[model samples]
Target: MPELERDNEVELAYGVRLRSSGVSATVGDVRQAPTATRPVRGVVADELLGDSGDAVARLLPVVEAAGMRTVLAVPLDDVQVPPTPFGGVRALTGEENYVELSVPGPDPDEGQVVLEVDEVGLVRWHIDVEAAATAVAIADNGTALAARGVAPVRAGIEQTFRIPIVQLDQGGVGGQQRGFLGFGVRKVLHLIRFPIEAAAAAVGKAVVGWWEDRRRPHALSLVTPESLGDVPPPDGVSAARLAELADKPFLVLVHGTFSTIRSGFAGLNRSGGGQPDLAELVARYEGRVLGFDHQTLHVDPTTNADWFLRRLPTDRPVTLDLLTHSRGGLVGRRIADPALAAAAGVPTPDVRRLIHVGTPNGGTVLASPKRWTTLIDVFTNLFSMLPEEVATPTAEAVIELVKQVATGVFNGLAGLTAMDPGNPAVTAANAQVFGGGASGAAGAVRAITSDFTPAAEDLRLRALNAIVDPFFGTGNDLVVPTQGVFEAGDYRVTDPFVVQSPSAVVHTAFFSDVRVRAKLGEWLPGAV
Candidate 1:
């Protein structure tokens, strides 16, 4: 162990070297601890053991079983890396100084180093570990920087890796204003390595099990008086209830990926100052509103639609209007697909009107296989700032997905791939649903889209947008592309309600807006 001084590289214990220039901070000796101890700090600890801890706890065992023997803890002072030569900062910051580590062995397992910078940026690791499939730099807040297609650079016999340890301005977002003070606590960097294949298998198993336990793929519950707004239904829709609801044109609510009906439409629960709300919408359908809750991470939308169709009563004909958000819109479209309905051996419900809020009909690049890590990064940062809009469990699901992706286990995530522009499923769906134009058999297709640019007063959101806007070159709602919601292949959406820039309305907050509520009321007219 040695003390690190400015402009001089010091060799610490375990064949690791530390160096710093332009930045001033006290670097502590690197110590090793067992991975079971969970030696983590700042936002990483908060994400792992937060309110959604139980949901994400399954990931730890996967990491431990991947031959991770011990964790390395590196301590440093509060440091901030200024904005890059470019306008905005990326997920990884401060590439100038490097923390080099040498593993003296013939062969070593795959390893990872988790670094945090004042709860903002993450340091990148350039690994030359032999036979390692990939090297990823993960931010404390669950942002992963991985070389997707590129193979890891293999050096000589002695495996040596250099990690860029940097800092972020504590005065910026998630700073003192947000009550994140890192004064006395030691900022420890946890380092662990494991076999890639074994880790991938373990991650896949754990995540699949977790998804199976949490998601109800074919569950459909009605919105009754007892389960009005953001309240979970006591039970699934019974055969009698379905027959009764099928007598009239009912409304169906479809939620997006990593979300439940209660969480996705929670925004509709807010009072709209004499405007229409969720209660009014439910009453319009005479309490016949059905909510489709399905698995979103593992299965494709067609599968979800098939499961949903199977739950419908075959004895009666049903007519329904659809209200969908995000990926749920894809499922709704599939349900509205007459060919698909026929294939599923069920009569297609007469879809009178379909309202898609923040739906990615044209697909979002963020869901591309290469950009999956960036998608997680965007969601993690957005959820950190807007915690109230997203439920903790939903956020935890995102966290778990990111963790699996970071560990090179992103092969089986078909649901996310369905949102990719190049995905055949998306192309086929677009061709079938919107191919016949807006007046197609699916009925009147409407959308509520937003190009969210944070207002001047929303400093935190603005700061986040500054870092995130670069990922999506065009206008977006911080998740899906703005124009993609309404503009598909040959079909051009007509007269969609668009939320312009420089507003507080984000993708998740659309239903909370009075103007959106007004638009919904105007379109549906609620039992008038």
Candidate 2:
């Protein structure tokens, strides 16, 4: 890396380019072969190229290989590097790269993939929920940060970063391929940009996400505790709907904690316009839909299960088809639990199928004391990223929110205790749902405990998010490390999606995901 000049020309030891624009011969000729001791240098200026002295060394060899006598820096070549606050770039597959939230953390362990916050280190206290919050911040603010010069990497759970493999022109540094970055003879800068449309899309999505969460809860509490007994059918349903339910098997969609009906099915709004192909799961089971909502934060699984028992017919010959997401899976589990039902004074419903979109059947790392510190630190950083005027207030708000989470539910709410892995209800559910042997509950618990934790994650996590961190702990969905819905021995009656993957399915998304929807179609009796 060299010092950047105001005119934008980057001065190398050998010569200077008009800019690092990656154009050929735009600057004075300087014949420096990359193989030579001296290297080539150049730069260009535009929206995302260079500003305030962003430079890189060892670029000469690559440029020389591209065969250009004059300097023409491609804007994309230097993205994801220097002067860029947002992106964190690393080799995903060999020389290829992958861009992520780009935050700091301890390097991963031998076989794990941990995304530890540099400050938080690891969860060590009730306040560590902030670390979990920070992970959320990275996800929430990721796109915004990318807007300011982050490179466009390939997309997928386990995708490639497409690094440039230079092929020197036959004519060498002054040849036909000069200035080209190897795309069938073109000198184009294919990189990400912060376009007006993108910003608009972000705004639109935020609004959509808001309305989705806020709008669905008041359907006369069709799924809420307030509407448990003899509640009128939800807004759009007709009186005939009850009769329809009696004749046909019904689909019950259970939402996770802090989620709404739309979140289980609809897509977040686009930053520019319109929406993604959200609600695919919802669409398939259209005729048989029954969305369930509940007070998850303060309420226990037994309470939610009781509501489910009250809402559905006790003696329906047909079992209800169930689709549960995140903690909703716990509710579904309770519905399936005869003992729990008996204890709660509720009748159990027969289940047709259970598809989970990242349920913490084994609880979450965010709840681990050793890991919460990291969670809190990351969230605090997110608040710090705000403007000073808002930062203080934002921090205060976060503290208050955490306070509620801590106190409102578990009498100090376990300090956001419901999510705690150590929660009695959560552990009990895992024991029952996964079975109690090594091949069952014990194994899954061990994986979630040793493999999913920040310490184990360092050794087990992977870029594909495939090796557990979201792939194969026991297999994980990033959030849920088991990579599956349930264990083989859990039950022969029906299968359950215990651990989730792709990060999306770990919590809020289920119906909106096509693969998930397709799986539902295959697994459910009448789903299309």
Candidate 3:
């Protein structure tokens, strides 16, 4: 310990080193001229810094006049955790009380230092290692008081300073130092995400409840046999006659991301600059329309698709046409399941026609790789695991736990080489969806291989495949990729224009430029 003497007053300073345990001090600073170094006495407030803003603000002035250039004042970054001092102050006033104050000393070990302050307001510190700690957290009796987001108290009277040590790495990763004195301790914060399975289960239960309430009343009324009660159609409504054929060749339109079925209806109710609703487009041609809803943000893509497919009515023979966008193409592809069709109480669909507008056959690159997966997981979980009002700090803790668990699972699976291919769960997601994967199956393989980028030059091939390739080998639109838009067994639209089958014209528009939507009414009479 070094003692400073001036004007009949002697300032004594001592040092203390801490790791994980509350530190103890032998000689607290004593500024009285007698030079009697004694342990200062004060109760450690369960709270770190006392509630005196003015005292904290006046700290620099008092320490500066005492010849001390550096003061350690730990501000609370997170109230729920410990307080860390990343900021520096000049000095402390005699009024603040601290039995023992930990200071960064001259000698540092492994880039670390330890120091202690006494009542004299003089600080004795030592560095043991070459690495200088970047930050410190202050606490009282193990209670963190101030650190990021907590403003320094502005009072001018007596003031005390305490801080938790924080270490900064070259790569940007940061850590807190173990507590050295009094009740101050180190704590860390982490980012979190929602658990897919847990959230799905919760929403699944909710949807099931909703189904029980609305199922019977709705009962696929679009296809239910209802005697046309001789009632006349409303004056402005033009679907009077088509209402009879609504039960046959029912058309269900599934909107893609961010769009709702009501969107089309709203558009029909109100004219817009964009394309008109299929109802109006088909109304003149006597076509009927049906819309389906599936969870958007709260549900996973494959699960949502499965739910939508199972909800379809397939009990009797039926010709179903589908129009989808974005990831909706995946829904259409999955619904081709014979079992799902049967479960929907509808006959196997006659494989009539399918149209996908701006569908992402493969996963989007934006959701691929590591960072994006974490981001999506976080966002989806925010809506899933937390109520709107729960403190973000609490929710964040929960989410972080979920993400850690998910990451562990992802890593475990990623270690595997062989796995079932047909299992829907096994094949549905990307290994890195939450992070990493096993065998690089459906989700994993796609995440690893697909290029979902926005760069223009790379898009030429993708755009060509998206529009022309679906008809490859036998024929193609030359825009959609063959492997994506077209199924393995389908050749109807693939046949050359002249050799085209009877369904060619009906499916022609599918392989042709999207402009064909304008003339669809020619064949279907009312479907435009």
Candidate 4:
């Protein structure tokens, strides 16, 4: 009979014996659960001697005396058990590892999940037992025995198993540390099922649901390019391209939208009186030049940005001078997260001297109307089976497109609002910033009113709010009207916004202003 000590609970070393396809092998004692203390040696001795007949033969007297047993006690060449008396454990030979860990269950539950780590030093084998529940037994060598009469391993419950390694204590045995990425958190799904298939489906659904919830961005934007060109590079202007950038005050150029590094640099080179090429820009400055790729609205910006950053080398230091056009600014701001900043060892941005060219710092009324309409349409289509007149109409396709649109618009709105000083979200974001000065907020605001408005009678000033409004009410772009940009805010009639940036002017009078390039050169001296 197995025995236990009065003062201490003996550790009964547990394992499995498996045989399949006419082959059999032994597995050694393996741990089924984490224990606070090492188990008593006496229990191991009784276990090895009791059930595993053949294993009892090789149990080292010293270890056997301590109550430890190997898994494959009997040789595969011999068949002794009638195979009928076996109730909880199944024996298989020649199929993979002969051993399988088995645990009987009235119905699958967290309690029934079979967990085991890789063995060390000897009996090295590759096994996986992550969050898994199984009707099986495991050996120190990773050998497992399936439960004789129980159903196969079910889903919803994870099974964690690993192979043994030569090193017992160097820490990375069986890649245990790497495999358990989601440590300390409960899996969102915990359902029970029969035959394993149904349970697996439940688990898959839960994972997909969790992923969907995290797929969208709260806000986003598509930035227009910023220009820093001076009138036709006069004779000396050519030198401007070669001008030393050290203490000369660098103008960090950040690209927006779907531009690549090559395209961004080339566009600047092709643009006006002309400035330095990327190489020249990098050469002239004492500081390093950097570029960033924000997540695509059409794609997940958060995830894309992560991939972008993952490819960057941020270990080195670079001087800070920033100029972001369009949506690139949102990404630039996010890198300002406290933890991220601290980990990267970067100082908070000095946005006081910061300047934006064609940045839509405030929510763009023009964009908002399109976005709002899109959202409305999405809701409409989701509820109806009618063919959408919109560009694409397949249910699945529309759903994906809508998700992308929503992510882009929401992130754009959030970024815009957060940049506003009096905005609540902005205040919350700054709570953790060192010195806590409000984030810089400035950008072009297109005028929705006509110059002749004053001459006309019966004009009542209104807050710029939505797209349909004629005068710069909430939603208007200069042409679209203020109503398009409507949201709760301090916008009012007396201090109405006016479009003044050179880019905005260029946008309004591209052909009329033949001197637009000249204006660009004057405003942005470092642009080509």
Give the TM-score of each candidate: 0.73, 0.42, 0.32, 0.31
Residue 180 lDDT, candidate 3, scale 0-100: 20
Best by TM-score: 1
Range of the 10 consecutive residues with the lowest summed lDDT in candidate 2: 103-112
lDDT of 4 by residue, 330-428 (tens): 444444333444444444322222333333334333233223322222222222221222111122222322222211212222322233333344334
True lDDT of residue 89, candidate 1: 38
List all candidate RMSDs to the true structure: 7.4, 18.1, 22.0, 26.8
Judge candidate 1 against the unseen true structure and give its global Cα lDDT, from 0 to 1: 0.59
Minimal lDDT window, size 10, model 4: 184-193
lDDT of 3: 0.28
Q: Write the number of the candidate with greater lDDT, choosing between 2 and 3.
A: 2
Off by over 4 Å in 2: 1-244, 267-286, 314-318, 340-347, 369-400, 403-419, 433-475, 483-511
> Best to worst by TM-score, what's the order?
1, 2, 3, 4
Our model 3 lands, by Cα RMSD against the true structure, at: 22.0
The superposed Cα distance between candidate 3 and the true structure at residue 346, in angstroms, equals 3.8
Tell me the lDDT of candidate 2: 0.35
Give candidate 4's error at residue 213 in angstroms. Answer: 17
lDDT of 2 by residue, 1-528 (tens): 333222244433332222322122122222222322212122221322122121111111221232222212222232322221432222211133212111111111100011111111111112212333432443344323223221112122221111221221222323343321221122222111111112323443221122222432323122322222222344534334544555655667676654444433332211112222223333444545666765454456566777556544444433566667766776776676666555655444456555555666556664443333333433333334333332332233233233222211112122234455545645554445433332221111111111222221221122112211321325444444453334322322233433233233333333435545545555555542
Residue 28, model 2: Cα distance from true site in angstroms: 39
